[model samples]
Target: MINSNIGWEISKNEFYSENAFSKIFDAVVHRTIINVMAIYKKHIRQIRHFIVCSMGILLLASSCSILPFGEVLFSNSESVSTQPTGTIFYDDFSSTTSGWDRSETDLGGADYMDGSYHILIDEKNTDYFSTLYRNYSDIGLQVDARRIDGPYDNNFGLICRYQDEKNFYAGMISSDGYFGIFKIENGEYKILGHDTMVFSELISAGDTGNRIKLDCYQDFLFLYVNDSLLDVQQDKTFGSGDVGLIAGSFEVSGVHIMFDNFYLTDITQTMNQEKQQ
Candidate 1:
């Protein structure tokens, strides 16, 4: 489960009870039909409304085929996710940020203060620090993060498959409504799936807490925030390496961010142990 947190745990029975598809189809049909009818009514005098009406009929037909009246794709007995079986390592950060040893700060630093990990970026300069607790080949890592101080124009999230501070994969979310996954090779940064950064409704804005998760299974990487799957892509740059956290400044310095409740589950190790047992 790439934690693309996008999965329906609702059983097929529950799905119908919820009437999700009907609600969606109703809204789409009503709005689309209304707009098409308005256009047809207006253009009827000029005989152009026929094209509009034809389109509306085609749209209605396609919409019916898109989901049909009542058809559920996935159904299950319990809340579900396609998660790999593994041993999970968890830290609520109640004690220290000690094992997060490697740091590269330009004008920023990561601290464990008042029982939470904080990344404070100075306005004087802009940079990020990579804090690695441990490394794994196929793994899933996630952390709870929110802004504590500084401007909303900052970026903070998880860094995984880290070959080093220079070369690694970064999954980043900004307070200004932007999210992206980047491949940093030899200190050069490039977007993974698309050339441009993206904005997502799945991402919470402002002071809201976000649980950013990155899943690394083989060469495929998936991004999930607040339990919603947002992005996915495949790459073959690096395999097994250290995983950690990162924060950077954008508009101003002194960007304060706090992270807690971290989880790192090693799929590789778990699989090996299971074989022996």
Candidate 2:
């Protein structure tokens, strides 16, 4: 539900608990992956041999699924809405030496292309993301993103508090207008706000550009689409980690996305500014 004070409040009672979400996600996703892999093996058995290659290893390890974190690890006694200030990191992807991963494989690729960071996935039920590898905590991240060439049934957005492929928080919106805040803790995926992705009219449909913003401050996570708050939840499994962009294909393969004008700011600075004011 939309809150005047906060964008959207996710009630733990109304949504799937940690164990329940994990069990269901594990069962459903394991079966789906097995089925997809069977089809993959049938069509392209040779791809399995590529795992020894570096790019193959990279993509396989980078692949992530939409998941969630269980029960709150800790609770913040104080809560405050922050106004971002003081840029911490900014990348326009105009240069290839900006420390983003560049890898290409038959499944997909991620690299700096034509002044933007690009990610493409040619495999079903898989996600590939590229991180800046910078450590951070309490960051406000924003980026301009759009599907370049892919199915409308895809997932792409920003990621924060990213410990690794196995642990991170993703604020995601599909091309078809679904949005959710998900996290993977210790290789177990769970959706923080809802049992499944929730549709939002604020998300731009099709290949149109959307300004996606995610605020990872303390235990609170807020996601905004086109400056409209889309999802809000609280979780403290990960306090700090890397930040990056992610794109994933569902049942349909070929999910390609490009991100540009990415910037991250320190939320603590904003909070201090508020206190002074």
**Candidate number of the best TM-score:** 2
lDDT of 1 at 230: 85
Candidate 1 displacement at residue 1 in angstroms: 44
**lDDT (CA) per prediction:** 0.57, 0.65
Q: For model 1, which pairs clash? A: 4-229, 121-254, 122-253, 122-254, 123-253, 123-254
Candidate 2 versus the native: TM-score? 0.71
TM-score of each: 0.63, 0.71
Q: Which sections of candidate 1 miss by over 4 Å?
A: 1-87, 102-106, 267-277
Could you tell me the C-alpha RMSD of candidate 2 in Å?
14.0
Tens digits of per-residue lDDT for model 2, 1-277:
1112211112342321233212111212221111111001112211111011112233333433211222332222222224336677777777878877666655566766667777777777667777777888898898888887779978888889987555789898889998878876644446785657777888889978788999999899999988898878999899999888888777778777878788898878876787899
